[model samples]
Target: MRIAGAALNQIPFDWAHNIQTISTAIAQAKAEGVELLCLPELCLTGYNCEDLFLSDWLPESALAHLQQIRPLTEGICVVVGLPVRLHQRTYNTAAVLRDGEILGFAAKQFLASDGVHYEPRFFAPWVAGETTTVEHAGESWPLGDLTFEHLGVRFGFEICEDAWRPDNVRPACRLRGKVDLIVNPSASHFAMSKTDQRYNLVLNASRNFTCTYLYANLLGNEAGRIIYDGEILIARNGHLLKRNQLLSFKEVDLEWADVDFSTPLEMAGELVPLPAPDEYRELNQAMSLGLFDYLRKARSRGFVLSLSGGADSSFCAVGVAEMVRLGVAELGEEEFKRRSGAFDEAKTEVVQTGAGGAAHQTAIDVDNAAETQNQKPDTANQALVNHLLTCAYQGTVNSSDDTFNSAKELADSIGARFFDWTIDEQVSGYVGKIEGALGRPLTWQTDDLALQNIQARVRAPGIWLLANVQNCLLITTSNRSEASVGYCTMDGDTAGSISPIAGVDKDFVKKWLRWAQTELGYEGLRYVNDLQPTAELRPLADNQTDERDLMPYVLLNRIERLAFYDRLAPAAVLAQLIAEDPAADAGQLRAYVRRFYQLWSRNQWKRERYAPSFHLDDYNVDPRSWLRFPILSGGFSEELAAL
Candidate 1:
C-alpha cells in the first residue's frame, strides 16, 4: 500500500487558501498513486482557531468546505481533521473520505489543557469505546472512538494530544492488532529538543503496535506566535522510512512511503541513533523561520528597530541577519525576498554607493576583497540584510559613547542601513512643556521615573517615522527580565509592532549573543556582548547597570521561572530558593520574592500592552499563550505579607 502524509500551512478562517492548498496536496498524492493520505489535526479551520471553534458559523463553514473536498478524494482515501459541533458541544474530529463518500468521524479522545492550550474550554474528549450517530447533510453518520475499515484494511487514529498522553488510554494500545495502520494528525508547536522526542515516540509506537505509523503536523506561524514545523514522518517496525524537510517555505509539503501490509517486518535489535540540532542551530533555524513567516504573513515589507547596542536590541538585529542568511541560502535572493513579500523593498536598485547611499544610511566593509574575488562575484546574503534592515541609534543626553559605538558597529557589520540620531532636544522640549504646564521644574530626585521615561519616549516618534517611511515593521527590544518588572516605558522603549525577544529571558539572550559572536562568526555581536547591560537612561557618572537596579539577572530569571512560569507562590519561591542555593541568605531570598511579586503584579498591564511576541517555551509571558494575570489585581499583597 502507498500512503502519504502532508504538512500544510493553514491560516485560521482563511477558507479560500485552505481549500486551495488542501486540494493541491490531494491532487499530488493521487497522482503519485497514494491510496491513503493523512493531514494535520484541525487543518480545515486551522489549529490556532482558539475561540473561533465556539462560533456556530465556523463548524458550518468547515462542513461545507469538507463537502467541496470530498470529490477530490475520489481516487484516494483522505483523512482530514476539523472541529465537529453536535448536540451543542464541539469535538476535535477527523473524517475519512473515498469514492466521493463520507465514511465516518473519529473524535479525539484526549484534550491538551496545559501550557498555552485551552482545548478543554472549547472541546470535550470523546467517550472511550462509545459510538454516536450525528446528523449531517441529511444523513446520520457514526462519530466516536472507533476503528475504520477500508479496502480490506483496518486503520485507527491518534489525534494530536491523544498520542502524547502517557497513559494506557492511548488509542494505539487498544487498536494494536485490529488496525494495520495508525495515523496521527498533529498541530504540535515547535520548541528546542522536541523533534528528537517525537521521532522516538513515533518509531517506538510503530514497533510496539506492529503497524505502520503515519504522522503529519501543521506548518509555519499560523495565527501569531506559535510555529509549527510541518514535520511529516513515516515509520514501520522501528525504522523510519520517509520524513519530509521541516519548516517549509511552500504552502503544502507532502511525504509518502510504500508499505507492505501482507508481511510484518521484524523489529531491529539495534536502536537507531536520532539526533537533534545544537542550541545555536535550532535557534538559528527556528527564529529565522519564524521571522520570515511573521514578516510575509503580516504583509510587512521589512524590519525597523531602535538599535540601542544593548543585548536585547542586538539580538533582534542578529535575527534579521540570520533571516536573510538562512532565507537566501534556502531560496535564491530573488525568490527569498519574493516569498517574504519583501521583494519590492529589498530588490530596489541603489542609485548611489558608498558611505552615504540613498537607501543605506551606513555600510560596513567586510574587507574580504580577496575572498570576494575568489568566491561568487555578488554576495547575496549580506545584500539581503542590508536591504531589509533599517536600524537607528537613538541617543539621549545620558547615552554613553560605548552604546553609540556598539550600535553603529553591529549595524555596519551586518550591512544594515544605519542612522544616528539624538533625542536630547526632544527630551528637553517634553520636559519644558510638562514643567510649564505644572508651573514647577522636575528633578531626578523627585521624579526619577518621569525623567527617565521622557528620554526613552522622545526617541519613539523619530524611529516610528523612519519605520513608517520605509514601510517596515518596527521591532521592539524588551526581554522577559525587564518585562517581569515595569522596567520598560510604555509608548517609549516598548513602542514597536512586534517584540521578538520579549518571551526570552535576559540571561539567555546575553548568552546567545556571545555564542553568535564566537561560534556563529557574527563578529558584530562581540561589541555588545563585551559591554554590561545598561538602558543608558541615567547619568554616566552613576555607572547605571540593569543588574544594579534590580536583582542579579541570573537570580531574577530563576525567580520568574519558579514564581510565574511554574506558578509557585511567593512563600514557596523563597523557601525553595533558600534551600537550593546555599549561598543565598534567607532574608535575601525573602526580599527577592517580595520584590518579584510586587513588581510582577504591577507590570501585568505592561505585559498586556507589549507587542505580540514569539512563544519559545512554556515560560512565555505573552497573554495569548502561557501566562495570563489580571491587569488589576490585589497585587499579591496578602501573599507577600505572609512571606
Candidate 2:
C-alpha cells in the first residue's frame, strides 16, 4: 500500500481556505497513486484558532466543510482534523473518509492544556476503552475506539498531543489486537530544539508497537503567533522506512513494504530500533522549519545583517544562510534558480589584504569628489569614532574590521550580495546634533544606558536603509537569552523584519554555531561565533563582557522557563536554583530574580512593539499573542520586595 503524508500551511479559522488546501493536496496525492493520505491535525479549523473554537457555529461549519471535502476523496483514503461535538462536549478529532464515505473518527486522548496550550478548556478527553457511534453525512460513523480496514490493512488514528503521551493512541492501537498501521495527524508547535524529540518519539513508538506509522504535521504561522514545524515519517516494524526532511511543508511519499505481524518480536524489533544518538535533532529541525517558513510565508527574498563580528550577529547570519541553502535544496536547482532570479557575475574585490600595519597607515589619497561619492561624511563615521575613543580611553580595543570580514565571507559563500557602509562621521555628527539639541554632553558617566542606546539606535537607520535599498529583510540578532532579561535596545538591535534566532537562548546559540561550523561544515561564518560579545559602546576594559551586564544567559533562560513558563514562585524557583548550585548566595539569587522580573515587566511594551517573530518553542515571549503583560504595571520591584 502506498501512503502519502501531506504537510500543510493552513490558516486558522479560515474554513474555506482550509478546505481548498486539503482538496488540492488530496488531488495531488490521488494523481500520484497514493492509496492513503494524511493531513495535519486541525487542518479544517487551524491549530491556534483560540476562542474561535468556542464559537457556536464552528462545529456546524466544520462539519459542512467536511461534507464538502467528502466528494473530493474519490479513489483515495483521506484523514482530516476538526473539532467535533459529541454529547454536547467538544473533542479534538480526526475524521477518516474514503471514496465519498465517512469511515470513522478518533478523539484526541491527550490534551496539552499547560504552558502555551489550553486545550482542556475547549476539549474533553477521549475516554479509553469506549466505542461510540455518531451520525455524519447521513450515515452512522463510529466516534470512538475506532479503527478502519481498507484493502486488508487495519489502521488507527491519533491527534497531535496523543502521540506524545506515554500510553498514547499508537500503543492503544497495539493493545486492540492486530492493527498493522497507525496514522498521526499533528499540529505541534515549533521550538529551537524540538524536532529531534518528535522524531525519536515516533521512531520508538513505531518500533515498540510493531506497526507501520505514518505521521504528518502542520507548518507556517497559524493564527499569527504559533509556528508548526512540519515533519513526516513512515516507520514500520522497528525501522524507519522513509522520513521527510525535518521541517518541510511539501507533500512526502513513502511506499510501505508489507510485513507479517505474526513474526517474532525480536526479529521485527531489529528492523526499526530507536534513534541511538542523544542530540536534540528535533529542535534543530524546528529552527530550520521556522526560518524557512518565516522567509517564504513572509514573502521575503533574503536577509541582511549588521554583522558586528560578535557571536549574536554571526550566528544570526549563518542561520539565514543555512535556511536559504536548505530551501534551495528542497526546491531543487531549477526552482531555486528561478526563485533567486539572475545571478551577479561581478568578481569580488580584495579589501584589507592584512599586510598594512599601524606604521603603514598612510591615508590613501583620492579626489575629494570621488571620496564624496564613495563615502557618506565624517558625521556618518561618528558612532565608530566614539566607539573607538571610548575603547581607547578605557584601554580596550573595539573594532569592526573583523566582523566586517566575517560577514563578507559568509555573504560570499551564501551567494548573497554584500555591501559595507562606513557612516562613522555621519553618526558622529548625528550624535553631536542630539547632544546639541539637549545642550549637554551625553557621556557614559552621566547616562550610560541612554548613551549606549543612542549608539545602537543610530546603527538601525543605516542598516534598515541598506536593507530597503537592496530589497532584503533585515535580520534581528537578539537571542532568547538576552530577550528574556531585556538586554536589547528597543528599535535598535531589536528592530528587524524577522528575528531568526530570537527563540533560542544565547548559550544554545553558541553551541548551535559551533555544531554548524565543526560538524555541519558551516566554517566560513565561524569568526562571528568565536568573537567575544560586546556593545562596543564603552572603551574595551579588562573583563568587560555582555554577560557581566546581564545575568548569565544560561541561568537566565532556565529561570525564565521555570518561573514564568512553569509558573513557579520566585522563592521556590530560587530554592530550585540553589539546589542545582549549592554555593549560590542570597545576594546573587535575589539579584537574578529581581532582574528577571524587572526586565520582564518593563519589556512588555518593547515586546508589544516588536515585529512578528517566529514561534519555534512552547516558551515563547511574543507579547501580542502568547504573553500578555500590562505595559503600565508597577514593574517587578514590588514582587521582588515581597519575595
Candidate 3:
C-alpha cells in the first residue's frame, strides 16, 4: 500500500482558504494513487485559534466544515485533524474518512503545556482506555482510543503531543502488537535545529513498535509568533523512507512512499542519518519565511526600517532581501507578488520603473574601494527588494559618519530605497522645552540619561510617519540581550510594529551578520561588521559603546539563559557563571550578576509592551510567549544581596 503525508499552510478559521488547500492536497493524493493520506493536526480550523477553541461554536463550525471534505476523500482514506466537542469538553482529534463515509475519531491523550504551547487551556486530554461516540448531523461515530483498517493494513494514531511522551507510555507502545502502521499528525513549531530531535523520535518509534510510521506537520507562520517548519516523514522499522525539504513556500507540500507490511524488515543498517543541522542557514530560512507570511497575512504593503548601520538593523534589512530572493526563487516572480498581496500590476510597474527612488533625499557616500568593487548590480531579486523595503538613516549630531556610510551602502547594495535625514532639530527642540521648564540648562553630567534618551525618542515620529504613509511595518532593532536587561528606551528604540530579532540574542546577531556577509554574498555588510556596536547617543569625545553602558553581551546572554530558560535564582546564576567563566574575577562576576538581576526585575514592563516578536531560538524573553515576570517585583534585592 502507498501512504502519504501533507504539510499545509493554513490560516485560522479562513474557511475558503483552508478548505481549498485541503481539497488541493486530496486531489493530488488521489491522482498519485495514495492509499492512505495524513494531513496536519487541526488543518481544518488551524492550530493557532487560541481561546476560540474553547467556544462552543468553533468546534461545531469545524464539524460542519468536515462534512465538506468528506466528499473529496471518496477514493482514498484520509486522516484530518480538528476539534471534537464531547460532554461539554473539547478534544483534539484525528478523524478518519474512507470512501466518503465517516470512520472513527482518535482523540489525543496528552496535551502540551510547556513553552509556547498552552493546549491544556483549550483541550481536555482523552482517557487512555476509554472509548466514546460523537454525534454530529444526526449521525454518530466512535471518538476515542480507536484504530482503523485500510487495504488489509491496521493503523492507529499518535497526535502531536501524544508521541512526545515516554516510549513506554506513548500511544505507539500500546498499539505495537495491535496495529501495523502508526500515523502521527502534528502541528509542531519550528525552532533552531529542533527537527533533528523529532527525526530521532519517529525513527525510534518505528523500530520499537515494529510498524510503519507516518508523520505530518503544519507549515508557515499560521497566525503570529509561531512558525511551523511544515515537515513530513515516512518510516518503517527504524528506516527512513521519506522526508520533505522543510519551510517550503508552497501552500501544500506532500510526500509519499510505498510500504509492504507483510514482510518483516531487519532494523540493522536500515537507518540513514540526517546530516548535521546548520543553525545559521536554518535561521535564515525560518526568518525569511516568517516575514513572508506576516507580510501577506497582515495585509501590509511592505517593510519600513530605521537603518542605523548597526548589527541588529542590518540583520533585518538582509532578512527582507533574503525574503525576496528566496521567495521569488521557489515561487515564481508573478506568484510571489500575487501571494504577497502588496504588489499588484500597477505597483509592479512602479517598482520596475524606480518611482520610489531616494534621489530627492540626502545621500551619504562611502569611501571604500572594496565596497565599490563588490557591490552587486540590478537583478530580479534587487528589483523586488526595491519595492518591498524602505530604509532611513535618522541621524542626530551624536550619530557617526561611519554608521551613515554603513546604512547607505547596504541599502544601495540591496536595492532598498534609502533616505538620509537628521533628527538634531527635533532633539534640540525637546531639550530646550525641558530646559526652559526647569529653568536650568541640562548637562550630560547632571542629566545624562535624560539627554541621551531624548535623542532616541525624537527619531521615532518621522520614521513612524513614513511607515504610516507607505503602509509598511516599522521594524524594531532590539535583540534579546537588550530586551533581557531593559537596555532600551521605551518609546524610542522599542517603537515598531514588529521586533524580528527580539527572540535571538545580541551575541548571535553579531556573529550571524559576519556569517551572512562572508557566506551569503552580502558584501554591503562589511561596513557594519567592521564597526563596534554603539547607541551613538552620547558625544563622540565620550566614546560610548554598548559594553561600556551595559555588561558584555556574551555575559548578558549567558545570565539571561541561566535566569529564565534554566529557571535559576540569582545566587545559583552567579555560581553557574563562576563555573562557566573561571578566568573572570569573582568580584566582577558578582557585580555583573547583581546588575543583571536588578535590571531584569525592573524591566518586565518593557518586555510586556514590546511588539509581537518571533519565537526563533529554543527560548525567548517575550513575556506573553515564553517567559513572564512581575511588572513590579522586589527588584530581586534579597536574592542579589544573597549573591
Best by lDDT: 3
Instruction: Give the TM-score of each candidate.
Output: 0.92, 0.75, 0.95
TM-score of 1: 0.92
Which prediction has the highest TM-score against the true structure?
A: 3
What lDDT tens digits, residue by residue, belong to model 2 across residues 535-639? Answer: 676644534478778877788888888877888877778778888888878679778877888888777777776766666556777664466578888775656
**Comparing candidate 1 with candidate 3, which one achieves the higher TM-score?**
3
All models: lDDT?
0.83, 0.66, 0.89
Tell me which residue pairs clash in candidate 1.
none
Superposition TM-score, candidate 2 onto the true structure = 0.75
Worst 10 residues of 1 by lDDT: 350-359
